[model samples]
Target: MTTTREAPEPVTDVELVVLLDEGGSPIGTAPKADVHTDATPFHLAFSCHLLDDEGRMLVTRRALGKRAWPGVWTNACCGHPAPGEHMETAVQRRVRQELGVDITALELALPDFEYRAVDASGIVEHERCPVYIARVDGELRPDPDETVEWQWVEPERLLAGVRATPWAFSPWLVLQAEQLPLLAGAA
Candidate 1:
């Protein structure tokens, strides 16, 4: 972990992300900005699906200011953990940061989900984003800088909407939907 001024510095895309080899072992690190070039390199990332007690899953729209896939509806949250950071710890922190909610348990639905996508602006996203399902039965106060809109919908309805308007959602979310069965046993 990098430190500065007697305290842990803030984690931002301006910092670095952990890279992985074909075997999923940490190989090295690269500045977040440099990792998403035209030829994006594979990096470690995560996606979280927040479900309410009523079986409604939360979905959020990426802030318009986002450099990639802005205004697109996606899973509850997505973020990258720094090198040596545990995935669960990262997800917990991200949920609190992005959704203003706290969670204690996480069920990893897709441990090997990976994808490479290039947005219209040409920025690329090549990541090994493991998907996790978490239950949150409370209001969502999303960070305006990270998410523009948020809502809860039944899993089946969300899947149907995404299929009916596939272009309205993120590519990874579409892929993640196909693997929803992995979350069948989740609460």
Candidate 2:
């Protein structure tokens, strides 16, 4: 008699975000889908800037169906980390899920980046978001639900564009460019 074993089903965990107090301490966890509102509480999040081998930065336009900042151009990716998940792990997960690409040389560029912005629709985004920079080496396969379009652009050109028309980009990206030395030369 021969016996065969079948692979077990994968577990699908409900996505929860780590909420933060005014002092930037973890207060609790909240369901991701229900957290954003006009009075969204401060939460932990991360942003990534992806670069190609030729040194062009990868930027993406948010999907029109996104709840906040839809159809707006922004960084390579941004996402909230799962409760108890490591920062780098969350970044990698979101990059793959949203852009369908792999990254290397992942480094934390801004360890204390935080922002609070209100979307045109009045949805508030208050996040203690750290910034990361990474390199990609493959063709992008962006998900339509997370990204509507993408482009590889020179850092200087992106900085100039953001500075020239701040209203054309996401608030966080505009604010980040002001502080990042990588774009400082363009100023």
Candidate 3:
């Protein structure tokens, strides 16, 4: 007789997100899973765009099971840093968690990149998201629960696609692509 065991699942509960005031002050903390609602509280978050040596940007299609924005393509990764955590540290951790890549160094390309978006399911995301850009390369091993597909894309081409089919991507991804022209020397 033989037996099989499954890998321990990552904990989703009790993950803390730093609540923020209008000016981006950390006012309080809330569980990550409960933070996004029709009336989402403003929170501090970060989005990371990874560029390879060839200058291709990494993008991922959100898994269909995502409650907020299912099957929509977005940046390499994004997440809220725990209260009092550095954005750089959070980005490094998240990139490893979501994309299975180690990010040695990263930079805040757009510190004032904030967005308020409501998905079709009525879940709201009101985040003070500082966009970070990193140049990294590795064999991508995306978490099946988080991503359904992945790709490397040219920045200019990505911008054109976002303009042509805006609805096909997450709101934040579209916004990021729009700001690509301003991200000189990011790669």
Candidate 4:
């Protein structure tokens, strides 16, 4: 007698973000797409600053189609950690997705980097974003949906530019530079 076997159904993955309370405690999870709006709630996210062997930082311009901070230059990558996802894992995943490159020497630079900003279009971004620094390990191939343009520049020069014209870059980048020792000033 011959028996017929059925194939297992494919599982669908819905991207979810961890929502945080005022005290930075994980409260619950929400769909990533629904979390960002005029009243974006506090969510767990991360920002990564990529550097080459010579210490030049990689910066990218946010795509014009982004809902928040479109067309503005910012750090190498930023992303929200999925529900139950590790912060380091999320950073690695996002850098690969956005810049098409892998990174090493990942270090948590700002563990309590939280910010809330309102874009000109009234879109709000409220995140408990931890900042990271990593060294690039592969060739860059930025995704058009995430990055329109990219360049590597000295961290000090980048800091000077952001300081001189804060309006030209992402609010988070400006805020991070102010707190990060590596970009604070020439040592």
lDDT of each: 0.86, 0.93, 0.85, 0.93
lDDT of 1: 0.86
Rank the models by lDDT, top first.
2, 4, 1, 3
Q: In model 3, which range of ten residues has the least summed lDDT?
A: 178-187
lDDT of 1 by residue, 23-114 (tens): 77888999876787787778899999988877788889999998899999999999999788899999998899999988645888889999
For candidate 1, the C-alpha RMSD (Å) to the true structure equals: 5.1
Model 2's lDDT to the true fold? 0.93
- Candidate 1: list runs displaced more than 4 Å: 1-14, 182-187
Model 4, 1-187: lDDT tens per residue? Answer: 9999898956658788999999999999998888889999998999999999999999999999998999999999999998788999999999999999999999999999999999999888999999999999989999999999999999889988998999999999989989987898632
Name the candidate, 1 or 4, with the larger lDDT value. 4
C-alpha RMSD of candidate 3: 8.4
* Candidate 3 structure quality by residue, lDDT tens digits, 55-174: 788889998898889899988899989877888898998888888888755878878888999999899999999998887757888888888899998877777777889999889988
Which pairs in model 1 have colliding backbones?
Answer: none
TM-score per prediction, in order, is 0.87, 0.92, 0.88, 0.93
**In order, what is each prediction's RMSD in angstroms?**
5.1, 5.0, 8.4, 3.7
Candidate 2 lDDT, 1-187, residue by residue in tens = 9999998966767788999999899999998999999999999999999999988888899999999999999999999999889999999999999999989999998899999999999999999999999998577999999999999999999998998999999999999999876778656
